[model samples]
Target: MVAEKITQCMKPHGEEGYQTIENMNENHKEISDFAFECVNVGENDKILDIGCGGGVNIEKFLKLTSGNVDGLDYSGVSVNASIRQNQNAVESGRCNVIQADVSDMPIDDESYDLVSAFETIYFWPDIANTFKEVSRIIKPQGQFMIAQGTDGNHPDDELWLSTVEGMSVYTADELEKYLLNAGFKSVKSFKKENDYILIVIAKK
Candidate 1:
């Protein structure tokens, strides 16, 4: 029951789950900052943040780029929270939050210059197929950045793997293969020294 509760909070579906994500954003500021540094966002790059919880990263991306930033989450609760958090940006026509699943995104093809997935791929339905979907939505030469706290080789992840049902931790090599097979032109991975943090960047 405890493990199930944890998973539910991670994928947030309702009011309580929305509160959980709000709290998570508060405590995960450092991890989010680390992930942000790995991506190279341009001044005019339109970006989409996949699984953007509470819209914190969307706010951050706004500061990083002068371009529009969009947030997509599978959870309606999360979508509402993200809109609330980024209300000013949305009102200014700078940001948009939508309830969307990664495997089946409701977005136009070749629309964005950058797509970022931060610590959210574990719950993705089909990792490979989702990568293809991400590729389809990105413009040619667009970049996809995936940031996770685990490198799949971390000793601590064994506990998360065992406890979190339907969660899968992927290694850099595994992710590289999936990205390449999904039609990415190049893939590169980076890790924080002495830490399990892994950030993989792929070009379409």
Candidate 2:
């Protein structure tokens, strides 16, 4: 029963999922902020947040960039929450929340200046191919940033893996390899001091 609730982190659904997303927004703030500090955000840079649960990060991006800030999530519930969280931006034509999968995003080629994945990607199907899809949508020389609470060495890693269905964790080395193979030119990773937080930035 507990495991089922944990699975909602992959693709949130109904009422329980809604609560999970809200919790994620609050819980993930620090890591998200750390990620932002690591990357450069231009005043007019277009941005996309993949697995943009509850749209908290989207709201953050809106403040950093004058260009459109879009969000994509596979879960309908998440999409709705994101839209609600950024309603003013959406209504003002500065934001768009889309329901889509990472492996096959419907966005146009070379559309964004920055693409970010936060506290997500453990549940991605075919991660290598999905990275390629991310590459396809980013403008040349644009960047991709990934931030999560684990570097795959956390004390509770095994417990979470066992508890959450289809969840997987990747080390910084593994992520760098995948990003490079998927066409990123260079990859740099940062680990928070005395913490498990991992942030990787890949340039295309």
Candidate 3:
């Protein structure tokens, strides 16, 4: 059912789980660098972080932007944890966290300068629908970036990797094709860690 297993795996284990993920280097470096490349945030920009999970990326983006950043996750537990973790940023109105699915965010069209999804799209049952939602919320020429863990380099793709129930690993070309089909322009991709992870940057 669309890999609801992801929600289960990330159901939250207090700060320890979030802390572990934040501290681990198994697959974050590339995704982090990709963030810097894609958004290239400015003082006046507004951004969105879809499937924000533990809100680490929102926290990172806050350091890069003087503008507002909004985070949305399908899991209420995740949203609460993210809020708790990024409370100061939220209180300062520089960041926000909400519980919502990737395919139906409670945001308006043409609302953001950038949209990012970090290691989360694989769980979406309808990747195209998810992109459609993301496209609707970004302004013209705005950027959309997807950061995913590399299945090949995940260190567990053979035994423990989690993926959409019946879907196979998506090649960079396949991902780009879908994004283009979804109406994204200027699509480009970057591979990290020997093809273990891929970052796709596209414009709306």
Each model's TM-score, in the order given? 0.94, 0.97, 0.81
- Candidate with more favorable, higher lDDT: 2 or 3: 2
Candidate 1, residue 50: Cα displacement in angstroms equals: 0.5
For candidate 3, write residues 77-129 as lDDT tens digits.
67876787789989988888888767777888899998887876666767777
lDDT of 2 by residue, 64-156 (tens): 999999999999999999999999999999999999989999989999999999988898999999999999999999999999999999999
Runs of candidate 3 with Cα error greater than 4 angstroms are 1-7, 10-30, 37-39, 151-168, 193-195
Q: lDDT of candidate 2?
A: 0.94
| Candidate 1 stretches greater than 4 Å from native | 1-5
* Full candidate order by lDDT, most accurate first: 2, 1, 3
Quick one: best TM-score, which candidate? 2
Question: RMSD in angstroms, candidate 2?
Answer: 1.5
Candidate 2's TM-score reads: 0.97
The order by descending TM-score is: 2, 1, 3
lDDT of each: 0.88, 0.94, 0.72
TM-score of 3: 0.81
Off by over 4 Å in 2: 1-5
Query: What's the number of clashes in each of the models?
Result: 0, 0, 2
